[model samples]
Target: MKYLVTGTAGFIGFHVALYLLNRGESVVGVDNINDYYDVNLKYQRLAECGIDRGNVSDNKKAVSSKYPEYSFYKMDLADKAVLMDIFEKEKIDVVINLAAQAGVRYSLTNPDAYITANIQSFLNILEACRAYPVKHLVYASSSSVYGANTKMPFSTSDNIDHPVSLYAATKKSNELMAHTYSHLFNIPTTGLRFFTVYGPWGRPDMALFLFIQAIEKGQPIQVFNHGKMKRDFTYIDDIVEGIIRVADRPAKPNPEWTGQDPDPGSSYAPFKVYNIGNSQPVELMDYIGALEKAMGKEAIKNMLPLQPGDVPSTYADVTDLKRDTGYQPQTSVEDGVAKFVAWYKKSYGK
Candidate 1:
């Protein structure tokens, strides 16, 4: 199937596009390549995907040098006219919308970016999918939507009405907006609520990346909640695998669904949401120790209280994911961190 994967320069999107190309699928990738973090890292990821950084220009297609089946374009999702043009030209069968303004703390300072990148961009994606009628629409959601919930193993069925951050609120808004399209237009929409994704080529703002950078410079790594937090850190490969699996299977009306007692995760329409995460929750201190072991150096850590808009813990219940797609996350935190450290050292020449 022909695929349109947005955010091709971003961490997860780059990996997904590369995986699809490697497996002999035609993929059209698009990313704004904004300097939200290091644009150089974004360029490097695109280069790895065989997209020449110099060839990239807004609203223009650049065919991959290495993969004949892969092509990429530099575009923002907020541009509906341009997005619709691509949908018409490419005849995309499946769309994986992975682009967004991606930080919880950043959203606290810059709420407008969240609205533009997350909400407006997603609306355009929904519109494109509605106009084009793709087989499946798989988009990224986040475990941050589980904000203010004290429940263990945050489930898709849980009501995520109490979002603590604007980023989480926007993600939740995506799910809601998707459901509307699914109901009104019969668009098959699946929202994957990703838990702490980390690996090689991870975003610079991510906790793992921050920790490694600080440790390498002998700076103190800030440990939030006095290092007493827990996170369900799923590796990037696992997330990509889950995306492919879910994309292959279009959402169907849940026969068990009822309006009397509504399930937030599923609907009478072709809409569903699943938590894609490692079932195991790792302690913050243990995660740091694993990184230290991988890098062969102890880190100087500064214990700090949980910052605003930060949740102390996140654990995902992936029951629906496994039941539907037989999806399972294989990499342990130790192995994953080791692999990331190896990549980081090699890439940074440290």
Candidate 2:
């Protein structure tokens, strides 16, 4: 099947595109390649896909140098006209929208970026899907949508009404908007709420990346929540596998749906939400220790309170994911961190 994957330059997107390309599927990739992180890193990822850095500018198609079945374009989802043009040309069968302005702390200062990237961009993708019918649409949501909820092992069945940050609110909004399209247009849509995803080619802004960086430099790592926070850190390969599995099966309506007692996670429409996580919560201190073990360096620590727009813990209940897609995250923190450290050392020639 032909696939259109947005955010192809980003971490998870890069890994997702590679997986699909290796499986002998044609993929059309798009990313604005904004300087949210290192644009050089983004370009390097595209280079691995055989897309020359000089060959791409913006909104222009660049064919892969190695994989003839794969091509990429520099574009933003908020640009509806250009997006529509791609849909017109490619006749995409399935879409995996992973592009977003991702950061919880950054959202506090730049709320507009969140709205523009998360809300407006997602709306355009939904509308484009309506204009060009596809078999399925799998979009990236976040575990942050579970904000302000103290529930252990966050289940999709739980109502996430109190979002602590604008970022979380935007993700929750995507799920709502997707449900609307699914109900009205009969579009099969699945929202995968990713939990603390990290691995090789992972974003530099994430905790694992940060901790590793500081420890390597012999700098003091800022331990948030005084090292009390817990996160369900799933490996990149596991996350990509879950996405493919969930996307292959277009969402279906729950047969036993009732309006009087509706489920937030599912509706009578072809819409569903699932948490794709390791289902294993690790403490911040333990995670840091794992990094130190892998790096063979001790990190100077500075304790800090839990900042606003932050949750103390996150543990995903991926029961539905396993039941529906046979997904089981296999990477442990030690193994995952070791791989990441190895990649970091090689990628930087450290």
Q: Estimate each model's TM-score.
A: 0.99, 0.99
What are the runs in model 2 whose C-alpha is more than 4 Å off?
A: none
lDDT by residue for model 1 (1-350), tens: 89999999999999999999999999999999998999999999999988998898989999989998889999989999999999999999999999999999999899999999999999999999988899999999999999999999899989899999999999999999999999999999999999999999999999999999999999999999999999999999999999999999999999999999999999999999999999899999999999999988999989999999999999999998999998989999999999999999999998
How many pairs of residues collide in model 1?
A: 0
lDDT of 1 at 156: 93
Off by over 4 Å in 1: none
State the TM-score for model 2: 0.99
Per-residue lDDT tens digits for candidate 2, residues 61-154, read 9999989989999998999999999999999999999999999999999999999999999999999999999999999999999989997989
Against the reference, the lDDT scores of all candidates come to 0.95, 0.94
Residue-level error in angstroms, candidate 2, position 128: 0.7
Error of 2 at 248 (Å): 0.7
> Lowest summed lDDT over 10 consecutive residues: which window, candidate 1?
49-58
Error of 1 at 210 (Å): 1.1
> Could you tell me which 10 consecutive residues in candidate 2 have the lowest summed lDDT?
207-216
